[model samples]
Target: MAKHHYKVGQTVSGITKGYTSEGLGILYTEDNSRFFVKGLIDGEEAEAKITYVGQRSSYAKLTKLITKSDKRIQPKCPVSTACGGCQFQHIAYDEQLKIKRGIVENAFRTIAKSDHPVDECVASPMPYYYRNKMQIPLGLDKKGNIISGFYRARTHIIIPTPECVIENERSNGIIATIRALMKSMRIPPYDEDKRSGVIRHILIRTSYYTPGLMVVLITNADNFYSRNNFVKALTKAHPEITTVVQNVNKRKTSVILGKRFRTLYGPGFIEDDILGIRFKISPQSFFQINPLQTENLYKIAIEKAEINNSHTVLDAYCGIGTISLIAARHAKKVIGVEINSRAIRDARSNANRNNIDNVEFYTADASDFMENEAKLGSKYDVVIMDPPRKGSDEKFLNAVLTLEPKKVVYVSCNPGTLARDITLLNKKYEIKSITPVDMFSQTYHVETVVLIERK
Candidate 1:
């Protein structure tokens, strides 16, 4: 409909930033064009090759590095740009924090129409190797050899990342062991084009403070060659593996896990200890990827809720009751609800495992739970909701308003959706404070915690 500033396959040199008072061009091209830049940073006079141009966004790759920014450093991950998992690995860590804060501030400024004073991003204790979980796709590389790594940006091509610094250190070794075993055993990697092969993906979850680790091998079929011996060899190599499960996904879909699962080794799940509460996480359970930041996040949430001995709390979308059990320690009672029955079962088990009698859980949608509670004239002094990236819907927020909780603490993973949700909640609540946490260190994504008061 209109003339575009850049073109695909065109090599542009040192495109200047569309300047703003907040100086928000550290990683993007201009204020108007939503640009996804790789191997390129602002303030560097380098030439980048425009790869893909879309209606609302564009992508560019640095063809040649004429000059480097002052904040750019040698990325720790060997497959930094190839993997596309962490875009900010090259930028200095301190600069990354500032960029994340600015992102949240910008979302609030443009979407929420609120000049909220966002706090400095809370830094992760371990900037590198902080992720407690890793999911790697299994496929044959160009040489027709079995390999496991992350997919390339926007493509299904696999980039071998043996030394990815963001993932847990032990993950690489386990992947290598599996690869070697597959090679020796003549098991082929999954071929997407042919829709043949056995292994599809490998998902690993490691406990932050405990000696529990689980490995899940996603396959296209239930049975494989020498399954018993394979499990034996895998366990012998990595004694830290507490459990191993096999998930079967036969459909030709992009989704990783299927409906059926069979335990090939010890238990079907693993447990992690955080904030003095033990959480049982199954393969499908929605747990935080960064355990170190998750501890800090839960602490910040509980503290911001300002729960007293006399207060009652509601935890919506509570997976495994991480926040509910933590809040139960400070409040008189806590109630948690989720749509996934499996997560509710784990939450109840977690509560009983920790002897937390004050917290209760239900297998129901959060919005429905809130609406029913409002209709029943039940009240909660504080409500803590950790919604998905899309954030909570308006019906849930409206129900929350009817409940009139004195304070609401929202833990958001996506800033854009957080701002949109806040605008809806503004009809009944006023923002008090906002804080960003560096849950994902090397990536552009951020986790934010906001506290609101009923008007």
Candidate 2:
């Protein structure tokens, strides 16, 4: 091992060379040592204090600004710098789009080893107040005051962010109401250290195309105290609140949601419309956070798929059958598969609610289902896979290859994993086109959709 040139807490000045995919600015000094920083832009000169140094790189906290990039702007939210929910809130929106495109291009070039021409990122219409859902943690301050906010960047410590610029305005009111109820009702917040208290977290979901709100109270116990009065008061405070569900999380882990659930009022779910199709959203189901951009993202994805009346589309990870129902209108038949039975239940109800019979949904592991489809000699003309942040596995990719769909439409959130999976699928499929959509505004995360065809 060798001694490093800089020590922790020592401030060093450097010009930013570029940005990492996680929206951290890469700075280089005269010694060629690299440091990753946040809230700094390209060609910006700044002095940053070293926080942690590793073998090849280090992370720093911005201390002083020497030269500011024109791309920088005044952040809308006061706690934007501390909240882990958003990055790039301090940068210009146009420049943020450029950086996201660069991120997608860099991932494909460096990881996939392809010089594919990446398209410009599709900007969201409402960059601010675009988020339809918010999951905030609850705790008590030192004075035993109820606090509701998000976690600090890379840490579990909550930072009070009541007026998040990206979330719906009603979310703030809902949170404020809950906090008041916690204080008045004498409900103590869950203490992670001592594993005591009651309310753990709260998830509020709002819809744009529809008129409904869903409030999911994540609790530390199954039996809520004064359950009827609590529900009545909450709904009365916010008349828009259509459904309220309780999820008990007694586990000693960091994960927020638990397996047990019980609906206290209403249908326990809310319906949102996308692309002329209605979807029933559950408490824990996976759905796009931004409604307007989700519409654009799905439109771009479907346009790239280019399905016809003769085509059969297979939607993997088809939560609530959003894409499946939309594609069913254009394709002859669409089959959706997902592992979450609850999401499958909502997906089926959505299909029936819309009276669309051309689509069928199955609750099964995508990899296992596709592999068994291979064994059964079932075929599909087009396969649309919208996997999680980890992307698809080799087993799923191999199964996709075995199925030999004429076209593969991959929708991904992580560029690195998307590029890696595309590299493997490239052996059997040729990349047709790639498009990036700004699903998450003021964040480093970008949603990319790739269209591939059999070589």
Candidate with top TM-score is: 2
Worst 10 residues of 1 by lDDT: 18-27
TM per candidate comes to: 0.94, 0.98
Q: What local distance difference test score does each model get? A: 0.85, 0.91
Pick the lDDT winner. 2
- Per-residue CA lDDT of model 1 for 1-455, tens digit only, reads 11286778887555534322222232344433444556555666556677777875565666776776788899887788688587788889898888889889989999999998999999999899988888899888778888788988778998987777988898889999999998988778788999999999999999888888999999988899988899999999999999999999999999999999999999899989887788898999888989888999989998899999999999999988889999999999999999999899999999889999998999998998898999999999999999988899978898988999999999999988899898988978999999999999988889999999998
* Model 2 collision count: 0
Model 1, residue 331: C-alpha shift (Å): 0.9
lDDT by residue (1-455, candidate 2, tens digit) is 11287888888888998899899999887677889998899999999998888886688999989999889899999998888988898899999999999999999999999998999999999999988898889998888889989999778899987787898888899899999988888888899999999999999999898987999999999886787898899999999999999999999998889998889888988889899888888888888999988999999888999999999899999988999999999999999999999999999999899999999999999999999998898999999999999998988899988999999999999999999999999878999898999999999999999999999
Residue 13, model 1: Cα distance from true site in angstroms? 2.8
Candidate 2 similarity to native, TM-score: 0.98
